[model samples]
Structures are given as structure tokens and as C-alpha cells.
Target chain A: MSAQTATIRGWGFLAPAVLWTLAFFIVPFVVMGAMSLATLDGRTLVWGLSLDNYRELAGQAYLARAIAVSLEITLTVTLVSVLLAYPLAWIIAYRVPPRWQRLVLLLAILPFWTSYVVRSYAWLLVLARDGVVNQTLMGLGLIAEPLTLANTRFATVTGFVHFFVMLLTLTIYANLVQLSPNYRKAAMDLGANAFQTFRHVILPLTLPGIMTGAFLTFVLCIGDYITPQILGGNTELTVPQVIMVQLGRRADFPLAAALAIVLMGIVTLAYLAMARWLRLDRL
Target chain B: MPWAYALALFGFIYLPVATLVLFSFQNGSLPVPPFNGPSLRWYGDVLGDDRLVEALLNSLMVALGSSAIAVALGFSAAYALARHVLPASALWRALLIAPLTVSYLIVGLGLLIVVQRLGLGLSLWTAGIGHVVINLPIAFAIIYASMGAQQQNAERAARDLGADEARVVLLVTVPMLAPAILAAFFLSVTLSWDEFIIAFLLTRFDVTLPVEIWSMLRSGLSPRLNAIGSLVFLVSVSAVLLLELTVFRKRRR
Candidate 1:
């Protein structure tokens, strides 16, 4: 084939993907940015370059509170999931025999395949007033009455942490297994205690993995609607829940798009902060 | 101590699924509380609900339809990029893969804005388009990663034998990459099948199973919800096991 023909064929192959991305992804993103600036006058969308929606975000108590709630929930889920997952990944990587590590890791993430919506609902059932957690506590004489576990921030956090812990475990485990044993031995030989070895050597070495996992946890948790929707019980709403309300109830596309843009901004900031260690294709 | 901690974590991980499956057999009206007689009543109810059944079919159609397009586009793109030199290929690849980092909610919202602006009515087709949008990058990545020099060599041999580009791609390239292609399709199906936000935002009366299940959750608590949840769990687990046996097991062997 001629070089010219090969280039044409290459363009042929690239055209579909390029067009699809441009149409559905890039074009829609651009339109959404434009839509965010427009205002709603009595259910009619007014297309204009105005910051009314953003200004509303600043003025409205609930909108600002939603942002705070989203941030607090996201940070809590990210930190807690990482804390829980690191130890689990550590144990799986070092304590479990190599032969069983794959099986162990697979088992750990099996629930990942389940419908995410159903999983959140399942957490609701498990944390309900008469549910297993409270029932077990009361059965063991640990409490005089059933605690308010469901439909609260605690429930929402628990649900988010559960999902993210599984995710963090996978990322952190991949990092842990890739570490050379020589590093640990080298540190110990240099008279570092076990805690010192971990704190000084292993922790620093694995910070990239931790940050990557935490950043992912941040992105996913903050953007998630299902967990908080099912588990949060309208006691308070996250940004996603508020966004949904704007779309579902009031048909407020302008404000919702603004919220979505704010969300994108937060995720962009997170990506920039962790850009060095982000191996997205690897995930 | 490590074993003990591992056991506790495992319990945490499996608790919801176990409870879901258990309550699916609860013979009671509500999904919560003390266990009752084991029964298939709710499962029967899930099968009986016409809307639920229709949603399941909708989910299947969307999953398969979107995945087929995603894989086809992704494969061609992978072949082109892998075989022929293209200018700014790295930039193109980044543009293609940019959606992977963005949240599903944002993607759905963006599509929703565009659709409404265009005055296009929401339907399962729009939902399928959204699924394709998300799954295309994944399909591309998987197929692209697997397109090594070996495939290129085989393609060259085919071309040298006078096999046209179309014939070479259809017969030689696709067959060689069958496993990866099938894996991407199956994975995409699984993702779209269980996907909620995109389908929820993009569709109208016709909804996917996840959207259907969301409605169920919102309306009331029922053993039927448990049944449907367990049913989805069963179907997904079966697909996963099948993939493990066919794909991963073959690779290992």
C-alpha cells in the first residue's frame, strides 16, 4: 500500500472514535458549560452568558451546605477507606501465601460486581433500626435500645466507606505486591525498628499508591448519588442529591449544570494535586 | 492476628450481599427483621412484574447494543493507531481516554443538557449512547493494550498474501484479538447492565434494571426488592464466573 493510502486508512479508523468523542463527550461538555451560564425564567431556559446560577450557589444556604456536606462526606470516606484498606492490603500482600493472594483479593472485591444501587439499598437494610447491626448489639447486651444507624450521615458514610475500602484495597494491594523485599530488609538492617521501618520506608514508598487510591475515592465518593441517596435518608443532601433534585423536581438545568461544573472543578483540582502518581490506565 | 483481622474484613465485605440473598428468601412482606420461612415468593413476584421484566430486557438490549458499537469502534481505532503512524497520536489517545477520569454523573448530566437543548426526547437509545460513551474508552484501552507486535506481524503476513485490508481485519485481526474483544464486550455489558445514573438521566419511561430497582427502593420496602436485588446479583455473578472460567482460566492455562 502507498504511504498516502495508509494514512487515509488510518484516518478512516480514527474518524469514528474521534467523532463519537467529540459529539457525545466534548460537545456535550461544552454545551453544559454554556448551559450553566443561562438562567431559568418560569421553566423556560434562557441561553445567556451570566453567572446567576453560581451567584445563587453563593447566596443559597442549602446549595452551599450541599457543597460542604459533599466535601465532608468525600474526605471522610477517602480517609477512612484508605485507613481500613492499607492494613488489609498489607496483610494480604505479606501474610497470605503468594499462591492464595489472587483468590484472597478476588474474594475481597467480589461484591464489586453486584449492582451498585442494590448494594447501597442492602446497606440500608443492614443498618435499619431492627436490622442486624443493632440486633446483634442488643443481643450481645451492648445497648439498651436500637441506635439510629440508618438514614443518617453515619449510614451514608458507612455505605461509602464499604465500597471505597474494596477499591482502595485493590489499588494499595497492587502497590504493596510490587514492592521489593530488599527495601524492608535494608531498613531493618540499618537498625530501624518495625514501626520505624514502616513509617520511614514502606509508608513513603507507598504514598503514591495511597494518594492515587485516596484521590479516586475522593472523585467517586463525591460524585456518587446512589449511596447517599439511599442511605442518607434526606436528613441532609450531598451535591449529587441536590443536582438530582434540581433536574428531577424543578427542571433547573442551569443551576444543576453549575453544580456539575463545580464538581468537575473539584475533581480537576484533585487530579492536578495527584497528577504525578495517577496511572489511570493501570487502574 | 492478621488472619483474624482478615476474617473480620471479609465479613464486613460480604455482609450486605449475604443479607441481601438471605432476605430474598424471607417469605415476609418486608425485607427487614426476623427471618421467616424460606420461599421463592418474592422471586416469583419479580418475574411476574411486567415492568421489571421489560426493564430487564431493556437493560439487555442497551448493554449489548452499546457494547457492540463500542467494541467495533474501539477495535478499529486500536488497529489503526497500532499499525499506522498518526500525527499527535498521544494527544488523540488522551482525548479518547479523558472520559475515564470523569464521573458518570457528570457525563450523564452533560449528555442530558445536550439532549434537552437539541429537543431530543429521552429514551433507552439515548441511554445506550451514554453507555457507549463510557464504555468506548475502556474498550479502546483493553484492545489497544493487547495489540502487540505479534498481531502486526500476522497482519503483515496476511497483507503480503494479497489479503485486502478489509479481509485482513475481518478474518486475521479480529480472530487474533477475539479474546480481548470478547472480554471488552462482556465487561462493557456488565457495566451497562448495572449502570444507573446515566440510564436514569438519559431514559424516560423505558428504564434499565438499576433504574427500575431505584424506583422500587424509593417507593417502599418489599421482599420483592430483595428478590430483584438477589436476581441481579445472581445474573452478574454467573457472568463473572463464566468470564473467569473461559477467559482468565484459559489465559492461565
Candidate 2:
């Protein structure tokens, strides 16, 4: 078929996806923008094109603190997932053969494929006051009393790592899979040791993968509601949880929208920064 | 890596879930264990738990309804985008794909607000409607991307051979797009099944599994929840394997 005909044909196929996106994705965002403007009155929103909600919520000390906490958690989770993922990803990429590598990668991803709620709920079982971790520690005679692990920042960090490390590992593995195995081999042939070869050859090649993994962790962590709600003690609240709080408990629609918008804004800015800094699209 | 590291990972990831499953069968109440002997009692308990059973049914109703409707609507979108050229096609594709990047909680809130503002009468049905609406783009994008690589000549040939547009679409195009359509349906079901926030915001007394599980977890974790998790695990694994074998027809390696 002619190129013109093919182009026309492609458009015919593409029209549905375009229309779907317009109706659902683009339309909802516009609706969300409108929702952010209206005020809540006893479980109902009194709609008037007013910034009163935004002004009220944005001015609050609570939002600012929640935003910071959200950022801190995102950064911490991003760092932790990356830290755990890179080494394991390295082993799978460089050391393991293709067949075993696939198995290892599958193992990494199997949990993610399982129910997320189940996994998050499972964290509760593990970290409960008289939970498995404590029982094991006490049985081992490591501590006199069962240490407080559940409903702490430590538990949240562990949970995030458990959930997201696979994402980092997979992203990095995809990158490493594309890299030339001979780069490290060449470096080693030139008198560099295994560690030095990896440092010089493998690391530079895999930076894009690392960056992509970190970016996913960062973005996903910021929007996370379940993990923080499950594991984050009353000591702190992430932005998403705060939004849920305003919506669920307080029935504060205006504030929830404002917080949702603010959360989106934070994610947008972080994404833009990462994209610009890493030239992620090019990678 | 050390053997302990792998063992630790297994402990972290599977241990809690396994505990839930084991305790679900335990002759006693709680997963905290000491030689209490196994029992099929928890399944009976879970079966007897009206709220949990109701939640599971509610989840199925939503997932099936949303997946079916979204898959249809998304098929339309994919058909148009992949076979027909709309203006600024790349931008349109990006717009559809953007939600995959955004959080579901935000998406849920955004839709709830929008539906309420439009005075569409927000409820679980409308929430299911919103889910279909949200998932339509995902289905479209996945299908569109899949069809993009195929040659257009097959459809042209079908048309030239005296088939009508409808017949050509059905026999020629759909058969070609079968794998992608299956992928889209499976993805939508999995997504709807797993999605917590949208269901939470949209439902009242009747809630989806994820939302129900969230409430249970928030109060405290129990092994009964693990039985539910294992069921979810079995469903996903079976679905993925079935799709990969039939639709994909590609080896994992």
C-alpha cells in the first residue's frame, strides 16, 4: 500500500484511542480542575468559581508539613529501592546466564503481580506487636522485649522496599540487557579487575536504567496511599494519605481537591526535573 | 549474593502471605503459631464472613462490568487511533497514556469530583462507570500500540475482495488484533480488581475487594486476609500464564 493510504489507515485505527483519551483522561483532568474550585457544604459541594478552597488549604500549616513528609518519604524510598535493586540487578545482568536471569527477574516481579492490598496487609501481620519478626527475635534471645517495629517509619521503609525494589531491578536489568557484555570484558582485558571493570564500563552504561528506576520509585512513592496508611504511624502523614483524611474523615472536598492538585503538582515538578536532568526521553 | 539474602527476601515477600494462608487453615484463631494443627476451618470462617463474601462479589461485579465496558469502548478508541489518523495523533496517544503515569487516588478523586459537579448522582454504579471511563484509555493505548506495527494491506485486501466495513472490521481486523484485545481485557480486569482508591471513593456500603481488604488491614491484619490474597495470586498467575501462552505465543526468555 502507498504511504498516504497507510497513513490514512493508521489514523482510522488510531481514532478510538484518541477519542478514549480525550473523553476519559483529558476530560477528567479538566473536571478535577473544576472540582478544586468548589467548596464543600455538609457532604455536598457548593460550586462557585472561587479560589477560596485553594487559598484556605494552601495557607494551612498542616499541608506544608504533609508535603514535606511526602517529599522526604519519596526521596527515602527512591534511594532505598535503588540501593537494594542495583546490586541484585547487577548480579542478574552480569553474573547470571540468560535462563537463570529470567527466573531471578521473574522472582523479583512475582510479588508485584500478586495483590497489592494483600502484600500491604501482609506487612501488618509481620510487624504487629506480637508479630513474626518480634517472635523470631525474642526466640533468638536477641532482645529482652519485642521491640516496637510496626507503625513506625522503619516498617514503612521496609514495606516500600519490599514492594518497589523489583521495579528498580527490572528497569535496570532491561538497560543492562541492552548493554554490550564486551564492554566489561574489554576493560578487564586492559588490566582492570572485576570491580574496576564494572565501575568503569558497566556503571556508566547502566546510569540511564538507574535513573529511570529512581524516577519511577520517586513518582510512585509520592502518590502512594496504601503503604503510608498501613505502615506510617500517627507520627507523620504523606500528602495522599492527608487527602484521604480530608475526604474520608473530614468530608472536606475542597481541601481534598486542593491537596490532590498539590500532590499532582509536586509529582509533575519532580518528573520534569528528572526528565530534564537525565534527558530520560533520549535514554 | 548470600543465600541468606535470598531467604530474607522470601521471608519479607512471601512469609506474611504464607502465614495468612497457613493461619486460615489453623485449628485456632490467629497466625501466631505453636503446633496448633491444620484445619480447613478458616475457609469456612471466611465463607461465613458475610462482609468479606459480599466484598468479593462486589469486586467481581465491578471488575467484570468495568472490564467488559472499558474493553469495548477502548476497542473503539484503539480501532480509531490505530487504523484512522486523527489530528495531532501523537499528542492524542500521549494524553491517553498519561493516566498510567498518574496515581489512581488522584484519578479517583478527580472523577468523583467531576461526576458530583456534573450532578451525575455519584454511587457505586456511577463509580463503575467512572472506572470504565478511566480504563478505556488504557485499553485503547495498549491495543493501538499493538495494531500500529501491523500492515494495513490486509484490511485493504479484505475490502477489495467485496467485504463491507463491518465484516472487514470483524473478520480481518479483529482476528489480527485478538491478542491485543485479550491483553487489554486482562489488563483492565487486573487493574479494576487491584484498584483500591477509585472503588473506595465511589462505593458506600458495597465495596470492592481492595477497599474491603484495606479496611481490614487498617484495623488489624489477620490470616483470613491471606487466604483472599492467595486466591488473588492464583487468579493473576493463571491469567498471565494463559495470556502469555495463547495470545502472546512468545517464550518468556
- Best candidate, DockQ: 1
Per-residue alpha-carbon lDDT of candidate 1 for residues B121-240, written as tens digits (9 for 90 to 100): 999999999999999999999999999889888999999999999999999999998889999999999999999999999999899999999988877677888889888988998999
Decoy 1 TM-score against native: 0.97
Q: A1-283 in candidate 1: lDDT tens per residue?
A: 8999999999999989989999999999999999999999997878999999999999999999999999999988898999999999999999999999998898899898779899998998899988888988998999999999999999999999899889999999999989999999999999999899999999999988898899889998999999999999899999999999999899899999999999999899888988897776566
Q: lDDT tens string, model 2, B1-253?
A: 5446655665666666566556666566576755266776666667798998888888888888988888786776667666665678677666666777778787788777667667676566866866776687678767666775454688888878998767888898788877778888888888788888788887777788888887876556555776677777777878877875677664223
lDDT values for all models: 0.92, 0.75
RMSD of each: 1.4, 3.2
Q: Please give the clash total of every predicted structure, in order.
A: 0, 24
- What are the per-model DockQ values? 0.82, 0.53
Candidate 1 achieves a global lDDT of 0.92
Each model's TM-score, in the order given?
Answer: 0.97, 0.90
Residue pairs clashing, model 1? none
- Model 2 misplacement above 4 A: A1-20, A39-58, A277-283, B1-7, B148-150, B249-253
